[model samples]
Target: MLLKYIISHTRLNESSVKNTIKLLNEDCTVPFISRYRKEATGNLDEVQIGDIVKYKEQFEILEKRKIAILKALEEQNVLTQELKQKIESCIDLITLEDLYLPYKKKRKTKAETARKNGLEPLAKIIMSQKANDIESIAYKYINKEIKNVDDALEGARHIISEWINERTDIRNSLRNQLERHAQISTKVVKTKAKDEKAQKFRDYFDWSESLQRIPSHRLLAILRAEKEGFIRVKINIDDVRALERIDNRIIRSNNTCADQIELAISDAYKRLLFPSLSNEALSKAKEKADEAAITVFAKNLKQLLLGSPIGEKRVLAIDPGFKTGCKLVCLNAQGGLEHNETIYPHPPKNDSFAAIKKIASLAEAYKIEAIAIGNGTASRETEALVKKIQFKNNIQVFVVSEAGASIYSASKIARDEFPNYDVTVRGSVSIGRRLQDPLAELVKIDAKSIGVGQYQHDVDQNKLQKELDVVVENCVNAVGVNINTASIPLLSSVSGIGPKLAENIFNYRNKYGVFKSRKDIKKVPRLGDKAFEQGAAFLRIKDAKNPLDDSSVHPESYKVVEEMAKDEGVTLGELIGNEKILQKINLKKYETQTIGLLTLQDIIKELKKPGLDIRESAKVFSFNQNIKSITDLHTGQLLPGIVNNITAFGCFVDIGIKESGLIHVSNLSDEFVKDVNEHVHLHEQIIVKVLEVDVSRKRIQLKLHKK
Candidate 1:
């Protein structure tokens, strides 16, 4: 039953989804199932598997709600056989709630009071559409409390209003009308018009747009403004059309009873239905907007995490500053901090000769192969100063992005790693290590603080955190982790090793030297077979006893590889990377009940490049020498830039200036660019033509260069 629902919702093959669910229910992780059980899942990727898991969870929640509702209805003695069946057949939460609303218990209302006063008989007479004298019927029910015909008729109308509000067809029709035609508008708060903080929301002060057509970012902005008390937001629809739709569903005749019913319809819509449905629509819209924003954030984070690394190079990193001296740290090829110092290369000090002497001496003394300067405060000056130093050994200089360096400096992770050092020293080390391996170092910091998102804080925090964690997990596993050298945070991102297990593994490594083989992980306390099965493939061990340990080949599949090497008349090491022998072996011959052609093919590929880093090597980038700030930019001049952040509307490029330039979607290519990632990526360097520059506002506009 659940399989059909998921297949219908996702429009995927039923058989594949069924098998994927089976694997998931067996306690297999998404990464493990997608990578190892490819044949069973029909080669579905992690995204499809994730969707299946999400929808299954949603259905489980709905089922639980249904059980609770059934229990409530049964307790109230209103659970008829037909109503029970109708509730069980419901597939949508909104429709199910609408069906159950009439039976729900509530506080004392005007309708309930009227019913208590013996006016329900008159309401039923009016609803019958056969009563020609509603006033007479209402007068018959009038008691000492009811003064006149008008008072009695008003009581009947109130009862009828509740009836109209509870009718399923009337509620559904009115809801559909509002969803299709509602417009959201905002107005500035009159009293706070002159406030400076409120002025930032000026764009939304007089904004009005169709709720259905509003973009996610704009909706979030207006909602944020409303939340901050800068503006009042309202959702409106054409009242005449809305009333006509409700009246058509409720009124059956033009008699005296129909007149009272018309009044009841208007009261129901204005007082009860419209407000409730409009709020529901707005809540749904907000959820969709949050999902869209979170998806974009997840994509940007994946790119940033998988960014190219400069790999294992001895680096002298500088955290540039003007007031305090520039914090410098010298790191070895293994990313361990060897030395740290402070140098004043800019501002009041102007100690150029001394700074140059110190840098050159460090390069020669530490055998530094590259220089990584944090792109902050005095970055340009530091880059220029470093470029002039004449080192005996060749050194490549790169200005690395320090988006979350400050956050990481003060984080508990940094404090634990560098107990003796201060924040400045820790920050320099993060900058240098990011250049060496972006994925490993970035896992230690929060994904939101990386600054590659739009309105990140406004989105759902739990959803954002979950999506970003998935991206981090996938990237960490894709690149594979060297268990011996990886940090606890990096190890925690592996497929099956969570925070607790990661701590255990770290402690085990500390107690007993380095992990000698993939199987050695099992010896750690609390590390069970299931954890080893899920994580062993993604963990690498260099110089292990078994050559396959360093590759992505699972230990369970080691026998197949051993058999292949035996058939090829060569040792496992000789058979690895030997294309002639690997190609000569028939993959189908090794297939068994558990293994298929897909898994066997992956094994062959892994043998070719044992434990290869899937990411590209980082390259040094130079910005346009003439431009350093917004004031230096001119219209129509072509300049080199690197894409710093991307959004649905456009991409922001860093053109060697403090202020990044915007490349709107329309100008991304000669053809219409639907997805910005298709044209550029995070940290991608490209040439752009400057189109406009607003120095006062500090905004630059540019167009992508045509191929």
Candidate 2:
């Protein structure tokens, strides 16, 4: 397999990467792999491993295209031994297309008709520079059909043009040159699109830029600009330079026909190379952008998915609103909505104190562990008021981002689940659930709605959606599913399950009771052996009588595992204990391809993992409660905060409450900072001292300079 070969060539030496691939093929989740295989993977981080997974997917795409191109060439009866070798050697889709450009069929054009008239030889002769007299050389091919110099020259150029177009090597060379030099530009046509509704685009008449360096967000913006009918767009580049390369490489030899050769090369490029290469460049640029945007989107999703979970606890979620009142939803530890209410303690509430009093009573009565307040209108005021409410011991309060919560609340899934609840109550539940387990809840909504990517909407929607879906599946599967209580939406995203099977699982659950063991999943409707094989490794049954069910070992492998245990002179149950014996056996001798030695080795290790919760542990961050707001901060005061976002310049920190503060790289330790990712990462809680506070601008500068 190419995947196997890639593993050999890559720098990833961790036992985890090998284990990850085997696990992935055998149906293990990324979260499961990273969390459980620290030793096996040589402790490779999730980000690096996830990158490997994504690259593998891209490689698969290129391989499929390669097969299709090879088939097409063979069918045309034009496939040569050398051409086949070249095609087989190409590693990327772009380079392969560059090779295939000439052999690809084309429309009937002036060039084809000229070749039919038999002037191609004269064109080649003129281009060869072997002829003494150009007129006489041209004259030999002249007949009533050949005509005068104008027609003769044009025909010769057309013939030479196609000849240059056919040379695969020259096409590849020019395509590369054009890509490096080409710039993309766009302009508004002012001419209204069929719809006159959006006139904004009419003013943005024209725009342009280089293809290589365009940022993801900017490219998406330009595409959006064009969509709104604001402008027409086209790419600009040194077409002459590209044409000149072909002239120098092929036509430079024959000085006799050097003038016509240069002219013919220029015509060929303009008529042939230019159009073909431009399309390829534009298409490749978009493909790259889509890939990058999808990657960012997938990473953001994985982050949101793998966000810490607060299981089976009482939570009060608030959808902060003004004038309409703050909508509240109380959810049990399992994320089911238990009750809902509304309060307006910010402004225009009949009696703000009464609302606060009622909130306090509910907090105490429900025994809520956390109050997840949505960061929205009047949220600050609400937070201030919530502080006044007395609660039972240490009820932590968090301000959760409500980015796509409203959209999810208004979605069909929400309506199906909570037909009787209002939009605001559903939104509150989303906000609450997101903080509990961002990954599990966010997977229910589309990735685009989560808003982590640049120019998501402007890129290829279908392509982006497919890639993002894979990312979600990969992430969800990475973190093993909780079989007892996972929602249909979550279960459906498990590597092997689809919408239909997901629904069937819910139906089985609703009809029967919670599954007592992993094997009991076979009882679920339409869950066959293949589906079970694929889905088993990622489904966790914490309460399963056997620990193996909760791990990555598939049920199909359980027999072989029993054999392993027996061979070791122990009971299957005993094998579960005294785990060091697992490394004693070599999987290669097992004699079952269905369950390889590599995979069996994984199962044995998983058999020793501490708990079924194969997720990163929750971190500790005791904020300086004194520094709740920037206005309260004094210069030179040091406080600990969680790094929420990283940019090219610095990191943004959330100091226990409302607004997060900026810590520029210059002050991030009084040392040089080359990469923001190198210095910090998402959700890394750290300590910093305040340097300056411009409350007027709401900017608080901090210094992270430390030993």
Candidate 3:
């Protein structure tokens, strides 16, 4: 039953959805299923498998709600066979809640008070609409609680209004009206509109847009303004049209009884139905906006985490500052901190010659092959200083972003990694290590703090974090970690191995020496067979005796690879990277019930490039040396820039200045750009033509250079 529901919603093959659900239920992570269990999932990638997981979870929540509603109906002694079947067969949450609405418990309401005054029978009789003399009928129900016939009719109208509010057909008709024609309108709070903090949201002060057509970022911005008390947001629809639809569904004839019913319908529409349904419409819109914003954040984070790595080069890193001087840390090829010191080349100290001599000496002493300068205060000056010096070796220089360096520097993780060092030294280490391996260094900090999101604080934070975690896990496993050298944070991102298990692996490695092969992971305490099955393939051991250990091939598939090597009449070492031999071997011969041609093909592909980093190697990119700030930029001047951040509306480019330039979606190309990522990505080098510069606002407008 769940399989059919998931397949119907996902529009995927029945067998694939069914098999993926089974794997998810078995606690298989997305990376594990995407990489090692390709045959079971019919070759579904991480995204497809992730969709299945989402739908499966949603189905479970729906079923749980159904069970609770059923129990509530049974307890109320209203559990009819038809209602039970209706609730059981319902698929969507809205319709399910509609079915359960009439039976739901409520607080003290006018309807409950009317029922206590013995006006419910009168309400039902008037609702029947056959009685012409409704006032005469209302007279019989009058008592001390009702007071008079008019009072009795009033109480009965309240009961009828409540009944109208609970009717599924009437409520659904109004819902359809709101969904199709609702417009979100906002009015600025007069006192707060001119406040300094409210300037960013001024565009939304008196704005009105169709709810269906509003962009996610725009909606989120309006919502943020409303949250900050700068504006009042309302979901507006034509009340007359909505009320007429409800009246046609409930009223049958034009009599005094019909008149009373009309009053009840108006009371319900104005007081109960429109309020609930309109809020629901707004909430649904907000949910969609949150999802869109989260997806943008997740995509940007994935690109940032998977940015090119410089590949284990000895780096001299500098956290540039003006008055406080530049903090330098020299790291070895493996990213171990070898030495740290402070150099004052700018401002207060004016120690340029001495700082230069010290930097050159440190480069030679530590054998620094590259220099990573943090792109913060005094970055351009420091870069110029480094370029002026003459080193013994040809050291490649790069300007790395210091987005979350301070956050990581002061974090508990950083303190644990460097207990004796201060935040400045630790920050310099993070900057240096980022150039060495971006993925490895970034996993230690929070994904949100990395500064690649649009209105991140306004969206659903929990959902944003969850989506970003999946992206990080996919990228980490996609690159394959070296088990011998990976830190605790990187190991924790591996599929199925969380923080505790990561710590255990670290402790085990420290006590028993480095992991010799993928098999050694099994010896870690509490890292059971399940974890090993999920994570072993992503953990590489460089120079292991079994060459397959260092590749992406799973331990379970090592036997199949060994058999293939035997069939090819060569040792495993020779069999690996032998593209001609690998291509000539037929994959069908190695296929089994558990392993199909898809799995075999993946194994052969991995054999060609064992544990290869799919990301490009980081290259030296220099911003135009002449442009130092927004004042230096001129219209129509072409400048080299790097795409530092991307959003749904546009992308931001760092053009060797303190202020990054914006490439609006309209300016991204002559044609309409549906997605910003298609035109640029994080850390991508490109030449952009400056369009305008707002020195007062510190904003730079740029266009993508066609050539």
Top TM-score prediction, candidate number: 3
For residues 1-707, what per-residue lDDT tens digits would candidate 2 score against the true structure? 55554565466764556666776676654554554445555656666667667767777888888899899998999899998998888777767886887778879877777778788888877866877677767776777776876687788888788878878788778767767877878765545544465443433355566788886556666667766666666876776666667767876454657778788888877777778777877778877877776665655555656767665678888887779998888888888998898887766665688788887878877778888887767666677677777776688777676778878999998998899987888899999998777777888887788765556776788878876787787778877788778888899888667788888888887889888788788888888876776687788887578767777776767788788888999886677746688767777778464554456666777666623455564443456756556678888887877666654457677776566788887877556876555666556668788888887767788877441
Estimated TM-score per prediction? 0.97, 0.77, 0.98
Q: What are the root-mean-square deviations of the candidates from the true structure over C-alphas?
A: 1.6, 6.3, 1.3
Better model by lDDT: candidate 1 vs candidate 2: 1
Top model number, lDDT: 3
Question: Which consecutive 10 residues in model 1 have the weakest lDDT in total?
Answer: 133-142
Ten-residue stretch with the least lDDT total in model 3: 622-631
Candidate 1 TM-score, true structure as reference: 0.97
What does candidate 1 score in Cα RMSD to the true structure?
Answer: 1.6
Q: Which runs of model 3 end up more than 4 angstroms from their true locations?
A: none
Q: Each model's C-alpha lDDT? A: 0.90, 0.73, 0.92
What lDDT tens digits, residue by residue, belong to model 1 across residues 464-493? Answer: 998898899888988989899899999999
C-alpha lDDT (0 to 100) for residue 160 of candidate 2: 81
- Candidate 3: tens digits of C-alpha lDDT, residues 1-707: 79988888889888889889888888999999988888888889999999998889889999999999999999999999999999999999999999898889999999999999999999999899999999999999989888899899989999999999998988888888888999999999999978989988888989999998899999999999999999999999998888788788878998889999999999988889989999999999999999998998898999999999999899999999989899999999999999999999999998999999999999999999999999999998999999999999999999998999999999999999899999999999999999999999999999999999989998888888889999999999999899889999999999989999999999999899988878889999999999999999999999899999999999999999999999989999999999999989988899899888988998999999887889999888888988876888889999999998888889999988878999999989999899998888898999999999889878899999952
